[model samples]
Target: MSRLPPAIFLMGPTAAGKTDLAIELAQALPCELISVDSALVYRGMDIGTAKPPSALLEAFPHRLIDIRDPAQSYSAAEFVSDAREAMAEISASGRIPLLVGGTMLYYRALLDGLAEMPPADAQIRAALEAQAEAEGLAALHRQLAEVDPESAARIHPNDPQRLVRALEVYRVSGMSMSEHRARQRAQKAGAGESERSILPYTVAQLSIAPAQRQVLHHRIEQRFVQMVEQGFVEEVETLRERRDLNPEMPSMRAVGYRQVWSYLDGDYARDEMLQRGVAATRQLAKRQLTWLRGWDGIHWLETSARDNLPRALKYLESLSILS
Candidate 1:
């Protein structure tokens, strides 16, 4: 396949030093940083999301961040559209596009286009939201089991966001979520795969080695505490003012936002907020690692950030992708 410049993917778990690495790489590589983070898309979700500071963002070109209000809906399909636009502009400007962040599904959507699911139905959305509120997430799980047993089995009972989305898709399309998912899985992966495919661009996954789990966890905890010190509570309070956007909304339910919302709602003691935040971050990291382990076309750097860049550049050079 002909190269379309390197589209380096700097991905790792939460608080795993991904942003710092990406920032440093941007200074050396001919790349424009584009975020694949699901949470960073929302505006006013600053400290809790661990978003880059304004000054840092100004120092480097970044995209797909703070483009929507907290109440606005931003899905993977939307992310693909926006990310591609950013990529094109960056490429035209003679720069590589560095895709970064830990949102695995967003990265997947960027690499492999989303299936053409039906547009959402307001009525169906209302019904599913009501059912989720009244019957709770378990009932949604059972509903998923009835419609798409495979996806139901795959998704956790507590992953209310995905459960509701699956149900909504079925309700709007008059087809089971399983059917749509099956079709998506049936598609082949390769050159000229689809317009959404990022194969024309180079990609790699750099890791800090698996043995550093303890260190990673410690970093995650330290980051959350730092976020708290940096006014994470105030950030959530600002988002809380928008009551129309419930904690169940896609943007509101983002990891840090959700935890901070709980703090605002008085669900936890003041001290417990930091503890709960740290645990949620750890869970997010676990999920990120799980996703990376299953991804294809992603070569591991096999070293910590300090030693990973040169090795990663070497791998990119071998692949003829660091144009």
Candidate 2:
């Protein structure tokens, strides 16, 4: 049998050294780097997003970074579309696509097909946002818990964007988002379709998970401190100055950016902000790992393992996607 063309998924929690591994793989393989990160898509979000430096990017270019303004919203659906096009382009040029990032949702949407849910209803979304403002996101999340406990449990109360979206999905379709997804899965399975092959490509997934969770937590804290030292606060301040941007915007809600925005708004002191930022990042990593755990056919590597690249190469070679 002919081996399917390969697409590499280098996924992990934040501060997992995915970027360096991706560059190393790109050098060793015929692959193009396509960022699977949502935050990296925003132009001015470099420092907080931990985007690769210009010199490094010049050496190993990553597609889909700096593609959006800070105020604009980029959804998982959009990421799937953009990634498919980039992957096709790369494959046509006889190069594999190495998608690298911590955005598990984007990775899932690209790999496992999403249900054909209704598109965003701006009027309904606006109304939901208004209601959230009046009643608070936690309150809205409570309402979601009543309707879609599965989604509510998965979504954080402080996550207004997801809260509003879940509520909007329910209000519009009279069915919870989780229910819709479940139904989609049932239908697909009944039809003898593989949910993981949503897109037309052979994928070799590589996940970098730290053996000790505390190791990841420590890395998260240290990375945030480094981000602060690298002008993360100034980056958020610049975005804060933009009239169109605000704390509620999805871009600003990014882990470090959100905490820094709160600090800038006098919501907390610098020390508290640093603490909250690190905590929020750790939470984000935990969430990413949860998603990673549920995924199938991934080659898991301990992030602290010294020979991760060799292990990943061996796994890919075993699959005949790399030789």
* TM-score for each predicted model, relative to the true structure: 0.87, 0.95
- 165 Cα displacement, candidate 2 (Å): 1.4
Model 2: clashing residue pairs? none
Q: What lDDT does candidate 1 reach at residue 110? A: 73
Per-residue CA lDDT of model 2 for 199-269, tens digit only, reads 77788899887889999999999999999998999998888888998887888888888889889889999
Off by over 4 Å in 1: 1-3, 121-127, 142-150, 153-156, 170-178, 184-199, 205-210, 302-305
Task: Report how far off residue 299 is in candidate 1 (Å).
Answer: 1.9
lDDT of 1 by residue, 1-323 (tens): 55555567777777777777777678778878998898888788888888899999999757988899888888788888888888888888988788888888787777766767777778887888798889899999998999889778656676887887888888888787679856765664423355445445655555443347898888888888888889888878876776687887888777767777887888988788778778877887887888787776676653354676777778778877664
- Each model's lDDT comes to 0.77, 0.89
